[model samples]
Target chain A: MPVKSLKKYVGVPRDVVANFHGKQVVYVSWDQHLLFAAPLMLCLPPQTTFRELVDGPLAALIAPDPDAAAVDWSTVQWLKANQPWVPDFDRSLADNGIVHKDQLRLSTPGLNSLRPAA
Target chain B: MDMKTEKKTLNLKERYRLLTRDLGWEPSYRSADEVFPYVKYEGIKVHDWGKWEDPFRLTMDAYWKYQAEKERKFYAIVDAHAQNNGHLNITDARYLSALKLFLQAISPGEYAAGKGFARVGREFPGVGTQVACQMQALDEIRHAQTQIHALSNYNKYYDGFHAFADARDRIWYTSVARSFFDDAMSAGPFEFMIAIGFSFEYVLTNLLFVPFMSGAAYNGDMATVTFGFSAQSDEARHMTLGLECIKFMLEQDPDNLPIVQGWIDKWFWRGFRVLGLVSTMMDYMLPKRVMSWREAWEIYGVENGGALFRDLARYGVRPPKGWDDAEKAIDHMSHQIMLGLYQWSFGTSFHSWIPSDDDMEWLAKKYPTTFDKYYRPRWNHIKKLAAAGTPFKNFGLAKLCQCCQLPVVFTEPDDPTLLCNRETVYEGEKYHFCSDGCQQVFENEPEKYVQAWLPMPQLFQMFDGDVAAWMDWVSLRDGHDNGDYDGSRDQQNFQQWRGLATSNQ
Candidate 1:
């Protein structure tokens, strides 16, 4: 649920991927026109470098969970075909899993207007 | 020590020499003019082809690695920001409106330039232009891609970005850019290089890029600023190529003088018309802070282009034809266009607000002619509405310029009265333009403008249900200003990143 909420906050209206079930993808929309979409597959244990993410055929993992190989790989294939993008499809998968190093603390004082009472 | 090494070095140059000059046999089938007819029609005589020198000396390997690295660095920024939720504390959601205009109006042009430059590379076989065209082509592609990539984050929250790529091809104001570049492409190679490369890139790129980037930085738009500056670094090199090409043509032959001058005149004005959008962006779009359009133009256009033109005059070259129109234009184009955007941008992009009292005062002083006399009246009227707590009306259509394809209603050169009344008739249908240069563009090709499907029409189409339902769209198509940037999701993300950075320290 937190991951799903994070997607909405990053500017991806959930309706876009209502059926995008393969993995959690975090998208950052800038300038109201450009969209950068990256999947969140394996979360890092936290405090990882750029290299640890590519441990194996990371592309294959997103390809078809093998259990779901009957599903279309065309979308994943197209993404891999255009890899090394400015969104860094490779590193994004690792970074998404970062375990929070800090405890969460927040209040609704600033956001009460945007949300109702919990 | 090297008897073998000396022999090998000599052998390499000989082989290259053989391939470049000695290997070519005089054409057995066709005469030179028959083969190179297009270059001659432009009236530029090239006494020496070898005089063309590419300063960057880019080979394939170095170019790809550097370009790829640039993309890597840019993507890393995107990733880091995404993990942390940067830009959650924006002053207001209204700021994204500027970005909406940037995406809808500018990104498609980048792609169009890429396509146009690719064709130029194919058509023009000369190495100098080919290399320049290739770099420009690549630069435009990166611009388009980076723009889309950066803005994608906004799509999760906004409404204006949807159908922007489609709108660029069909929209009315967009025709201003499409027609301008198409004119360059259809013209001779030298004219294409000068009009687009020199006139647009060198003359006004700083004016366009600087404010947009500065506003990005000021507003906490780090990703947008990163992408803009990265493209700008490449633009510096492109500007060098543009300047070099112009100097080369001027020095090549005395007879080449008039043709080059005419192109300079025509393109400078053509390019100037497209900048009307930028003028409005500078003066009105930036929320947190920015230099006004009048100030930027004075420093960049007047000071820079003014100096460059003066230097060119030593070679007997005059300022581009219709320069006076731009001189007149800089006075009031921003004020007028911002007024138009004020009425139209609601519910679609970021909202437009009246200029602050200080900003208006600055405009009055900077644009001594039009501000106090012409625009101040309109601003005062809008201020009255603001005071009444009444919202501005939705949708307005400014009188379109016949030549530049921009809206009319610009103030007179020094008068600010006549409302910049200029018109042209082709096939008996009268067309209006903000300035003479726009009129020339339309007269040059009326068929193009007649077909423009400007924004006013497109908005009507959207309202008429031709487009996807608004506020019911999916991710990446959500558009700008979902109203979350101010301190919700973005705030949470920022605090998290800061905490992580601090804790890691």
Candidate 2:
């Protein structure tokens, strides 16, 4: 359903749509630590959520490595990265809100909070 | 009674409405979509053309009057600077390389923006959008002319300023700017606005303009400083347009958000990649630096960009995909790009110099995280080679990124020593990227980027593997225009000119 929204909204060709839907790629950024991670060759289904992306692909790639010392997985909060501005993350990649190649960053919940204090 | 005395003057808002909004006419025969076909393909759903706002309220009469006054003052300064031999007043002749880079790489981009805005001005359906774009179109052309006029005095004495249009099209380094504008021009009007207006002007213009203008003032190049200020006034309006365009598209339809967001992700990376040259120029090229590229990025990009994104939170937009990577790049991009340019100066139009011990010390202080550990050793090695009269340079052709078209010189994120090269096999051909950011860009539109015009591969093929033949093909005067600035004609001429001025005094 969200794939249809993506196709209708962006007007991407069916083949490109199929490629986006079939592939599992999410661009991840942690702004606080200046860490970015994206899978070059890996493919995940279109319906992958921010939680799944971080818990699955990101944690596997970053948590076990000594080089990812800056990325503390326990404190990570996901924010949907867009252009001109960024907004709070509240949806899956396949949701009508998220498009292919859309960027998401892992931050501490309060570090760079987009939500306003009441 | 005279006709001027008989006429009554209209207020600013009334005149603007009369000039822009009241001038629009619906197509009699052709449908709206038929008349404006380009906006549809980009999938930006603009329900009402009237929603597009002209923030400057700049009607043509006011536009011309304002521009003319600015031009008159700008040219007067240019004339004064030329008559006074302003080139000799600079901190060093080496400072002119930044101007040379600006002329060859950046001024041509302004021309490209002029052409792009002209096309989009006609193509967008809204009269307000059209008028705004047309004004910007003229502004961009004025920027190009002013920059060239400001720098032409130096051209009389320098080597690289000539044949910039040709060199920009053919040179490997200048291709970064060329391809960026070409990309924006080729896109639909909405995408073009998002690419240039939003990402470049709104988000990144300060990073490019502020430092260069201040650097010019600091180095006693008043002509360049004047031109920079002149263009910067116009840039404010352009930045407003960028912000308004993004908000207009997002507010129009829920569906439009994704399409606009996708563009933001793409163009932010593209613009950041192009700023590699600017980063190097700010940090390394200027004899008296205005600010370190790291400090500028933190102020203009990280701090300001973070604030901007927070404002857009309700619209569900976030920072660009490469936000973190771009921030990290402030530490290392200048050193990497400078090293690449220094090693390949013989093939370029501008001169290159090894960093003085003081310069290296400045770099280490600015880039505390990575400079001393990773990059300092390399510069020290190059210094050692220079002392031994070898002065290392890579004569071989480097494999360039398929997306950015830059040499694959970026380092791995974790290990700063290894080159951060990523390759993807698409349609049976291997595509290379300088980093994950660039690789992600290519993966987004493989069909579009597969057709990139990489100059190095083309030159290598054209010259049949001879770099000297390639140099001849590109018309770079090897000994005179290219190589070390220490003993170059430009340097010697500056020294002699200063000596003459001193003796005369």
Candidate 3:
């Protein structure tokens, strides 16, 4: 039924914009790490930090389901590809020097079972 | 009695004028509006029909003679190639997938162009312009015929080359091309010129033809290369016609400038979206890569197209909108599209394979910034999964963009990782686009595009939501032709054919 439900939403996650040459692009994985969604295109104005994005656009875009409990902000780990999870919400995406279109998997404190053991 | 004999002979220019412009007949009872009603609706202003230029001075007599000679020479090569088993000379059997794609996706587009140009040729008010359109109509038809003839030999040895016109109408991926031409055909004559003639022929033809022909040359498919060369000469005149049409429109009235610019913006993005297929072929499908898609885009799109816009700046024309987004997309479009095609090969007419390590290294060298860091890892993972006996293929249908009909695979402009899902509600129904450009195209002419023949919805309605039934309805034989290349019928056949040849040798 879920797969059929996906068919109703006529699009797949195939378009990956890979042109981040000579710029700092941060990759943050979202949605329980089950789906390989495209990264957020950061065209925010200057002086806008990653913290602002998480609080404002990202939170609004990926708010927890009403049926599910709210996700704790501080307990979420920002893990890079093949790297251990790091809990640092204060650092900006620009400060992380993330390459454009790179994969950044999100890990919550108790949601380790949702992700493959890494 | 000796009579003074005198005869008058017209020069080339004078003969061209007499043959083209002087041949128009005025209606005795009917008004011009009644005769040429379709030209006035698109809001394109043309004050002087005399201003339309016939730069090639092409007449029907000369056209027939020249084209007949080229056809003669072209078919000779096709015959030779077929007799010599030229299919075996290709770099690898896998390379024919590119040719198969060209046949199914692009060759039918030529036939559509023929029909569109014929309509425009009859409807336009200017005689000279009509003659030019008529010639191009003939050229487009010839292009379709020659391509089909050139590739018909491969049908005996391959699976995808058969039932191309059927596939173009029914296949999900083929809709990317069909919908584009359908859009152009349904517009007014002037907009048709801008959409197909200018945006497609002049702006993006090089990126489409050059790499494919060169790829053909590198792979020893002489017949295909010959077809490309023959079609290209006609393309030169078509390019001139495209340029002439735009300039004539802009020079006629200042009122036409904004309209022309809007069409350019709309059609350029549309044309670029169609070229997504060609981009994948140039980068991934060719066994011996002729040039990188990025390199081809820079030369054909950025340098030449940028210069053309700069030259036109004197007439208040700038480059098309979304130029920046297109430039950025060049780095990742081919890589992204190949992954999609490889994963979905089971549903397609052709086979797909993972790039070898050597191919990946070459891609890394070509795309120094992104390939090594971003794409290579994903590919490595896919290859590992495939080795572990779990290859990726989408079992469910994909949602296609309402405008381009391509699978919504494009990411956001500024960020490469995020999917750019843009939608607008029209007539209480929401329409989705892959990017802002496509969304803008839809919003501009919602009435025209809202009627787009999207394959997925049609499949659901017509085939009871079964992909296998849909494939059967479309004439694509499953397992026999479509799937991974390693153990498919085509690959196995090629191995057998080559083995026999080796034994005889």
Candidate 4:
């Protein structure tokens, strides 16, 4: 469906990768973790390795969750834009096919984020 | 015999007709299409201009007299409320968060409505519609001013009320409202009326207004309550105009049904997204609760809105497409939104806190089905985190829905635990929505949403991606303006002042 307008109507999206000063906006959703409101948006360089994201910014972002320290990355599953993608920890984000504005759903299979014996 | 001819003054109804209905002349030099360029663009065909009616038959002279009387009474109460140190009279300083949110996020929308109505009034070909829109323009501006006037007292004695106008454009949370108005104001005249006048005023105003007014009355905010009372008549007039326009459009032609239905579907969901903020405020912000957001929705949204759609059914109009989803959401929306707010309190102008034990108990009783099962445990996690001296905060920003401009905090309707995330690739740029309803709205009009200056994305792009710079850009004074309600300056001052107001020590 198109916009009902008097003139030509399609517009350039404001959040395209070109506008973000060499960084791509990636959304991280921790499965079953309702505490962090919504997915956290992180602006990262395209070359940042998958391992660096987990140990650095991703680690800091999910630091408040009690389950963060217990996650087994080897067994954890990842979905990028609704499709399953295995994490090559040594590979860059661009190599993993995670582009700008893509949402990566990190589902820890056995690690449900229920009230963790607090 | 030629007797002296005496003239009697025109009656109110006659004067109203003379002033409003009789005040149009067709353009001779320019074509109608040239004169009103936006009228035919949306494809709503109007056969007659005479069908539009103002139920009150209000003329400029009578309108002035009525509004002037209201102003006199309202200002008097405002002055008294200020002079009497009424700031200390609220149920708690915590209640001020609702006021701050109202002023910052919602009052500016009133001003936007005023501007939208004025622009559409000029574009509309019908003289009656022009008159109605003109009158509503004045009403909306008045509502904005009076709301600011009522809440300005709190500015002198509060933390978060200082930069409401600035906050409307710059803050992250308020973009939901600001962008909503921007979307309406930028659209064609017919869509503007459907979006603001009918969908907003007729269908959703009660959910927004009733809670604030009744909350004010219940919480002892005399100034806010007085403003609410003063705006009551104008609100009624606005509602009448909304209903009249919707009915007129439906009656104009059979071709308009789909167009009108599409708008109703779009704006109802849009309005529902904005109301999610109000739902949180009603449930969590009020110190002395009037009713839970769930109760208010059942009454105002489901009950009153049901009767309205039933009447509209005669015109072959059904309820909004998002109506059933909204019903299922009432149980969980407030809790989800409040939890988000509590965690993200670090970024907001208003204070947020974990609900007290009593407050949680109230919530548990109100939402017995979902609260304990899904939300209560989350709050308990946050509570323990705060008690351990590291209060939880989502330090990063959130991705916003392109259409509604709200963060995608809402969850799947059936599963309370999973976030309801919807996205589509429009012109190679991916856009996200919080629900199917919002997604459908975006898919219909990709052009308008693509240009939306989303605050979060731009914060990184424009504000050097620095937290302090973003805070400075948004006019938040770090520690003072943002954070938890407990131990904040607002709390300390209220407790100390209330002590001084009552005690001899």
Give Cα-based local distance difference scores for all models.
0.58, 0.77, 0.77, 0.89
Q: What is the lDDT of residue B49 in candidate 4?
A: 75
- How far off is residue A27 in model 4, in Å? 0.6
Q: Kindly give the stretch of ten consecutive residues in candidate 3 chain B with the minimal lDDT sum.
A: B391-400
Per-residue CA lDDT of model 1 for B1-505, tens digit only, reads 5354434433433543443453233556897666555666556788876676667656545567778888998988877766655545344444666787788777777777787777766555456667667877988899899988887776664455656665465545566676676666655667777877788788878877888888888888777887986787788878888888888888889887887786787778877778888887776666676777877887888899899999888777999877776876676678767766554433233346677788788777767766776566556655665567654442223334434555454555765433444545445444445565666655654554554443333333343322334323312232232322223333344456556755874
Give the winner by TM-score: 2 or 3: 3
Please report, as a residue range, the 10-residue window in candidate 2 chain B with the lowest summed lDDT: B456-465
Question: Across residues B1-505, which tens digit of lDDT does each residue of candidate 4 receive?
Answer: 9888777899988887788644678789999889989888788999887777667788878888999999999999999999999999999999999999999999999999999999999998787788779989999999999999999999999998999888998998899999889989988998999999998998999989988899999999999999999999898999998999999899989999999999999999999999999998898899888898899988988889999999999989999999889888998888888888877787899899989999999989988888888888888888999999999898768878888888898888887778888989977888888999998988887887888888889888997578789888888988998899999999999999999999986
lDDT of 2 by residue, B31-131 (tens): 97788777877677888888888888987888889999999999999999999988789999899889888999999999999999999999998988998
Q: Which CAPRI tier for candidate 1?
A: incorrect
Q: Can you list the residue pairs that collide in candidate 2?
A: A24-A43, A24-A44, A82-B318, A85-B318, A86-B317, A86-B318, A86-B319, A87-B317, A87-B318
Candidate 4 lDDT at B321 equals 96
Fnat for model 4 comes to 0.84
Q: What is the lDDT of residue B264 in candidate 2?
A: 89
Q: Which docking category, incorrect, acceptable, medium or high, applies to candidate 2?
A: incorrect
Best by TM-score: 4
lDDT of 2 by residue, A3-38 (tens): 112233332222222333355333444443211111
- Candidate 3: where are CA atoms >4 Å away? A1-118, B1-11, B503-505
Q: DockQ for every model, please.
A: 0.01, 0.02, 0.03, 0.69
